[model samples]
Target: MARRGKKKGRPISGWLVLDKPVGMGSTEAVSKIKWLFQAEKAGHAGTLDPLASGMLPIALGEATKTVPYVQDGAKVYRFTVAWGEERSTDDLEGPVTKSSDQRPAEADVLLLMPKYTGVIMQTPPQFSAIKIAGERAYDLARDGATVDIPAREVEIGRLDLIDHNADRTIFEVECGKGTYVRSLARDMGRDLGCFGHIAELRRIEVEPFTQEDFVTIAELETARFGGQGDERSDSADTVPVDFDAIDALLVDTSAALDCLPQIAISDDAATKIRLGNPVIIRGRDAPVEAEEACATARGKLVAIGAIEQGMFKPKRVFAG
Candidate 1:
């Protein structure tokens, strides 16, 4: 029999709310963090474009199982829309596609707010991550292919004007997952008789994470290598980092499951749940029915499952 190779990197697990900087894509950010921590596995809950900056929740090791919960949560963004010219990418990065001399009045912009609020249909930008027949929309656009992307429903919890000027307008929006801020800028521009594109954009909040929870890439680097920045390590393969300090920056894995119903179980029950077995939950106040629930033993998370007929059935178990 052949010997199996051992997995490399530490088995760290948790969520890291990264204050992602501009000019770095979400996948690149995750890869960098994974290298910084030397973790065996890592993934991001949602994608943030290179042009967008702010909260990007990263999951490492066992926490990756809880990604869907965080990804489905609401997002808050503060963006500035540049008026008079629309771009091919719906941002400053692309060539000008349309231009206008008219700028919308403050009253006119405010009047149109009601139309965008609540549930609305939105068409994603051509230069977006949306898949078109197994290919990215942006890929097709880059290949000079004209793809007719269909509009879809998205929820906007709140949309407010933060500041306005003759050439640009700043607005803060709280919207559901899959909502595109660039689309908002483009559509609003067309409606106002002015062409527009995203001049600047920053996401401040994602559900289950507060503004204060995010840590910058610089901060993570400093924590690992002691403020040396790029000169901290002589070699990328043999870089020494402060594991304790870097690990301290990670939030608990259960934090992402905050929205789900939580149930407490005994160690014995937890053992069974971890072994992929259902256990009967006791107590009169215990939940009898829940479509989605989290089970915790003592203080640590055990499994994500559902309660049916007073039994806790484990769907996904976490390693201790």
Candidate 2:
């Protein structure tokens, strides 16, 4: 029998919190990062529209296992809504579908904040990634088909009025998973009797990752090519790629599990976990039961599991 061939590229793993620039899609960003790192696998925590910018946590190789944790985490967005014209996509990228001469006053915007804050049902923009009977909503919208996308519950922890003018208003929001900033602007505008759409959106925080952790594409390129400054070097054809420097940019895979409770296991337990076996969690503070927890030994991630009656049952084991 012929043996299967080995996969190409480095088996590198970890998270790369990127400062994704506007006009680049999330999948494109992940692909670019994967190519730059020459990794065997890659994925992103969440999707950020092409018009949006800021921290986009990308997972490489073994780190891809933690993507769901980051995706379900809370996110914070700062956005500006341009009033007087509602667009098909809920952003400037779409064509105008409705118009209004009325502009919301700053006082009026403030008065409506309470309505948007806390748990609310939101219908996503038509040109969105949401699926309708297995097909993407954006694809259907592009084909000139309109679908009645139902509103779903989402929680907004806080919504503050940052600034406002006759034409636009800026807001900063802290929201849970699945919340749409575009919907917030659209709904707020409709309630205020002013048509509006998202003019700008930036995600500054995604749970454990924040603005400070972000590295731009230029920086990654510079690090890989040994550029003189922070900007990407134009001499890619001449300079050799620095794999070490590029690898340094990765955040540890365990970092994504910061939200979960952790248990320190012994070498024996680590060995058992690596082989897909459960082990007794031995510690005075060992949780008798937990739905989700991470196990570590000798400062390395062993497995992600749950504590059941003092036994750590492995769910997902890490290569490291």
Candidate 3:
């Protein structure tokens, strides 16, 4: 469970490309950043486990509107499989459940790749965040319940072997939403007749944001107070808010809507869209035929909408 945030705070808005360090949960990271920025609202686009680290795009204030788009985008991960043992949770966090002395050759591991590639069915690890009847699956598993996670189809764009050794095999995979790399490692070991578990995992990319844009927590704090003189708050626990510095570190909300087709709307149209009304997209602004678009007015994002016979209807409107 995540800690509840304060109801009253500064209404800061924009995207923060965080280079999440290992051993920090995503929920805690959001809370820390929100407090550092003194933001009224904050949320993350994806949940990165504490054991794994890399790009974790945090949304402040109105930027939360774009979270769904980022979640649906493709993701890339690099992980290592430690063979000879399998954990109940499917990762290093879980207790060892099975083991085998047999090891599979690199060629044998490569041969199994095609079977798991493209669209395939996978059962999520028991110790996962997936909810079951309003309760988290991990909680259920910890309580000694047999969490029968169903097998569902997930998209795997690419899965390639980078390095292979007697005890560990390193690999990189590009996949879509709902695809669990832990499940892949577990299944791979089973296929090779040797038990295995994910030894280490790191996310290298998520759509609209990549490792190149990641900013470490220390880096963000440095940027916040680097040139602000000794203007620390009297409380010592609280940091003084610098709007100009915040605006510099944060990116516009439009940055996350890059996947959507862009459509430039008039100021009047933007106003109507904000009121939950449909606006007629101009001849040149809209794409030839797109179901959805990112409508902007003069350079500011207005709303994300659907195009029905050229009529752009607001689906998600941005208030900032």
Best by lDDT: 1
Residue lDDT tens for model 1, 1-320 = 99989648888999999999999999999999998888999999889989999999999999999999999999999999999999999998999999999998889899988999999999999998889999999999999998899999999999999999899899999999999999999999999999889999999999989898999998888887777774435464463554798899999999999998889889999999889999998876789999989999888999999999999999999997
Writing each residue's lDDT as its tens digit, candidate 3 over 169-203 gives 99999999999999999999999999899999999
What order do you get sorting by TM-score, best first? 1, 2, 3
TM-score list, all predictions:
0.95, 0.94, 0.91
> Cα miss at 84, model 2 (Å)?
0.6
Q: Name every residue pair that clashes in candidate 3.
A: none
Task: Please state every model's RMSD to the true fold in angstroms.
Answer: 2.0, 3.0, 4.1
State the displacement of the C-alpha of residue 266, model 2, in Å, after optimal TM-score superposition. Answer: 1.5
Q: How far out, in Å, is residue 229 in model 3?
A: 14
Candidate 2 lDDT, 88-107, residue by residue in tens: 99998989999999998899
| Model 2 residue 78 lDDT score | 95
